[model samples]
Target: MTTTATPLALADVALRLRPGDHVAVATRELRRGTQVALPAADGGLVVTLPLTVPRGHKLAVRAAGAGEPVLKYGQSIGRATRDIAPGDHVHSHNLGMDDADRAYEFGTARVALPPAAVERTFRGYRRADGRWGTRNYIGIVTSVNCSASTARLIADQFRGRVLDAYPHVDGVVALTHDTGCGLVPTSDGAQVTRRTLRGYASHPNMAGLLVVGLGCEMLPVDGLLDGLALAPGTPVRRLVIQETGGIRATVRAGVAAIEEMLPAIDALRREEAPASALVLGLNCGGSDGYSGITANPALGRASDLLVAQGGTSVLAETPEVFGAEHLLLRRAVSREVGQRLLDRLDWWKGYTAAGGGTMDNNPSPGNKAGGLTTILEKSLGAVAKAGTAELVAVKEYAEPVTERGLVFMDTPGYDPVSVTGIVAGGATVVVFTTGRGSVLGCKPSPSIKVATNTETYERMREDMDLDAGRIVTGTATVEEIGEELFERVLAVASGEQTVSEELDLGSDEFVPWQLGAVT
Candidate 1:
């Protein structure tokens, strides 16, 4: 039989996994006693072993029956459908998953990672609000249904001209959305929508902002600033289309406002900083087999480094983590944090069921073709993107991240909506992993794509930035590649454009998750 070979030491792998973890990634095909390398550091003789079982399945220490829990990572992966032997490999052979049957031992093993005593830093824009920004941007925020065109015209006008003067600032982007009008007045949805918009309008990343509105809409332009505590200034002129006399007049006013903001925005300069200032948005799409084995795990390691350095790293995509919620709960910093995540899980269950869908309705045709079979399988793999950091907090979509460590944001699995919420929450940079190669991106906050395997990296060489394939191909361990990924984050934060962002793939991709019935 053949084996993957890595020249580096994976001796630290056990640090991230439990000793009783049933699976040992095979070092060489053996009838038995393969002497697989374990760390002599865990106070044990370093040795590896071969499985008497078939490939792709891991042995279980305890027996589990139908609808019973199968434990891996010392947590429930899913429920078993048939009786499993003590040493039987835990997989689809005897397991089935149902949301109703899923249970958790909340607060049982929640670990609070003591804040890494060392202060951290990163290359970023120091916003006036004391929040460090990963990218400097000129924001064009539309206030009413009337000023959408004016905002677009203004953004387009500054595109090339502004970039030339302020090479440090990302050029004007008109954050145009279709829902500025026709919503229930003073309703919860309207409030949340307005608050989210204001958050973006006054986001730290924006060097300057221009708010433009039409004469009227259900969401009034004049009232938009009433409750917002955010500070946005110079070049942040608000103009009403009705007062301006029409689209042509409004465009002129908008252009003048943006032009006024340009000189000041151009004067902002970048300064040396620590990596801790970086807030990383973790995402994955178009997954394949290597996603779990390589890129995602590597991305997770990078997350660990960020957290260790006092930076924030966020994990999103609620549907993708459907079956794997318990793993996160176990690592949560406290019962309250774990419970908040559980609440989101419960809401999603009811929400999807109301729409006549089940959580197991996952692992798309593409995912299955790439070797994933069920939602549980996909989630177990997807959780790797969070690394092994303790869950510090669970946040609402678009809410500011308060924790200085690993955090989770509840969001739909849809990529655009998820990324939109992420950017709205103030992530300065994003790291996306894909096995089948997703050429997706979010502007203002640039994204770096990591390929899960060598073949995908080769095929999409121009699209992917780093390859975590080295893990599976044995050229590197997840830890080594993780550090590599961490360094890449710094490079990108310092203004490197990811392949997808360079190709301008972020337009037509702004979807805010619609969470309610239209009634």
Candidate 2:
């Protein structure tokens, strides 16, 4: 990446991330003929806007010929679609990408982070399996869509003040999905669903678990629990809607079963544990131009801090990291880990091709509205959440995350499904970054949302937990915001409720990655 020496100031009209970046992002709207002083790092050039550029949009700082590469973050974002003048706006209208092959050089840039100067600790629940939990949630997991309503009804009984006596217990959550019956038992979809369900049933954060199922489904209740071993002394129960005299009877039985288990579940108390016990999940959504410049990089710095303390941080949304995969490859700890990431990318290539789509078909409408132009541009920004830690491992969707430091889990870019796979993989807490805005939460794990820009943060103050926009506005450095975020992570892990938690928003987002036909 290109290095820059200039520090941004409040009066700056635009911000240039690197020395040789082809475009600089507008700090605020600039009408035609407005003059901007490019940062000294960007060669101290003065340019006039040929057309109006919206806040958070990019403006060309240097001329480019048609099909020439447009550089940002000191790397190629995409090739120009037509001749682009030095003062013109740079966006989808004149920028696009191609499927150019990237050469892999594993372990070439790997650098081990120095150990933390002082050991950090958080108050967490220690489980019998030698894992730590940030929350004490009782989960109602359903085996099929058919039993979803019954599970929800059962969970609803404990809402409001019913759990007031159980101060330690985070609410009872019903994690339901839209699959289970029509899928072939031996199909890939069935395996993924079964794996995800089993992961949740045995999650360290779950103080108690209840599995609900319809009597006749491809994924049987007995088979689902065949090899599952939850923490020792953890309460568990099972109910079948069909065999329990339909939905009403099952709901009654389910609620009663949980009531009986509450004492034991609530008895668990938080104990101080080393920071290594924390597994932080990293993800982003509703990205705008400032996402890469602010929140994403700030989250990355926080991820690096956790990793330096010997903790694990997981970066997901494989498709979101498409064009920027090369960056991670260079930092892989081994060729095996790098190759595993490649294998998953290869699978995605075929998967998208089979569905008549391309890997570049990302940057959703919200992303574009926020000034992101292409998947390449979005991927580069998205990968910043991983920080500069050495890539320790690559895992399949919903696979258990056993490695420490920075790990990669293959998942689609959809926020809910991506976070579900991460939580299933053992992330005790999540740090989600957003530019436009997102109200996402994960059950059994607390999610901390950080906004990329101050405008969005102030506009949706109730939804965002932190504002990384301070980085671009010269009020704070990236390291300062990052340190603040790390502190927030520790605070939330120690039984503090996040905005999403206060609003009770996680139960409706348990979407497992369905991989095959319903049949």
After superposing candidate 2 on the true structure, give the runs of residues whose Cα lies further than 4 Å from its correct spot: 1-11, 38-46
Candidate 1 has which clashing residue pairs, if any?
6-474, 35-48, 36-48, 121-274, 121-275, 121-276, 122-274, 122-275, 146-214, 147-214
lDDT of candidate 1 vs native? 0.71
Candidate 2, residues 1-519, lDDT tens digits: the string is 222244233137677777678888888887776666655554566666677888898888877899888988988888999998766899889999856776779989998999999999999999998999999999999999999999999999999999999988898999999998899999888999998999888888999989999999999888788879788888889999889999989989998999998998888899999999899999999999999999999899999999999999999998889988999999999999999999999999999999999998988999988889989899999999998999999999989998999999999999999999999999999999999899999998899999999999999999999999998889998889999999999989888889999899888888999999878
Off by over 4 Å in 1: 1-100, 112-120, 144-147, 231-234, 517-519
Listed per model in order, the count of residue pairs whose N, CA or C atoms clash below 3 Å is 10, 0
Worst 10 residues of 1 by lDDT: 7-16
Please, what are the lDDT tens digits per residue for candidate 1 over residues 18-37?
45443323221232333333
RMSD (Cα, Å) of model 1: 6.2
